[model samples]
Target: MRMIEIEKEQENPKMNNLRNFYERALQEFGTSDEDLWLQYIQEELGPWGQPENCGKIHWRAMKFLEGQSAESFTSKHALFQSGRL
Candidate 1:
């Protein structure tokens, strides 16, 4: 997972495009199907996604994501909180 500035959670041009792409991808994959929700969250929290909009992603993921995907996100978040991510 990559690190991103967690201040305010805004967006930029690159982030907008990435968001759009992810939305289309999620739509195609039916959201809960085969996916890369974690990667999306990482990108949203990375350099491309300027201000970081991962909070929304995290909440959505916890609700929609299942199995190992859900567990992975939980673990990553925990590591992040502990500054070990």
Candidate 2:
């Protein structure tokens, strides 16, 4: 456990940078806009041939973005039904 802690401490700077990068990306792209979200993931994560797992992450992000769009649509529909919009 001590060794693991030491290793993590050594890697703390790198981890913090990565976390900040993702935080900025999420702030920019975590939205109901699917196109922007997809573009962000593709540019940040790169092509499908590299780090192949990124492709999966990209697909999952797209799916989640689609779900967000659906939810937005549902909310809009509800508003329309209630004659609120």
How many residue pairs clash (N, CA or C atoms closer than 3 angstroms) in each of the candidate models, in the order given? 0, 0
lDDT of 2 by residue, 1-85 (tens): 2332343355333433443454455555554554443333343443222344445645545455556674664465356447684
User: What's the TM for model 1?
Assistant: 0.57
Q: Which ten residues in a row have the lowest lDDT in candidate 2?
A: 41-50
Candidate 1 local lDDT, residue 72: 73
Q: What is every candidate's alpha-carbon RMSD to the true fold? A: 7.3, 13.5
lDDT tens string, model 1, 24-85? 66655534542356667667666667435778777777877677767776887777658796
TM-scores for the candidates: 0.57, 0.31
Deviation from native of the Cα of residue 79 in model 2, angstroms: 32
Pairs clashing within candidate 1: none
**Best candidate, TM-score-wise?**
1
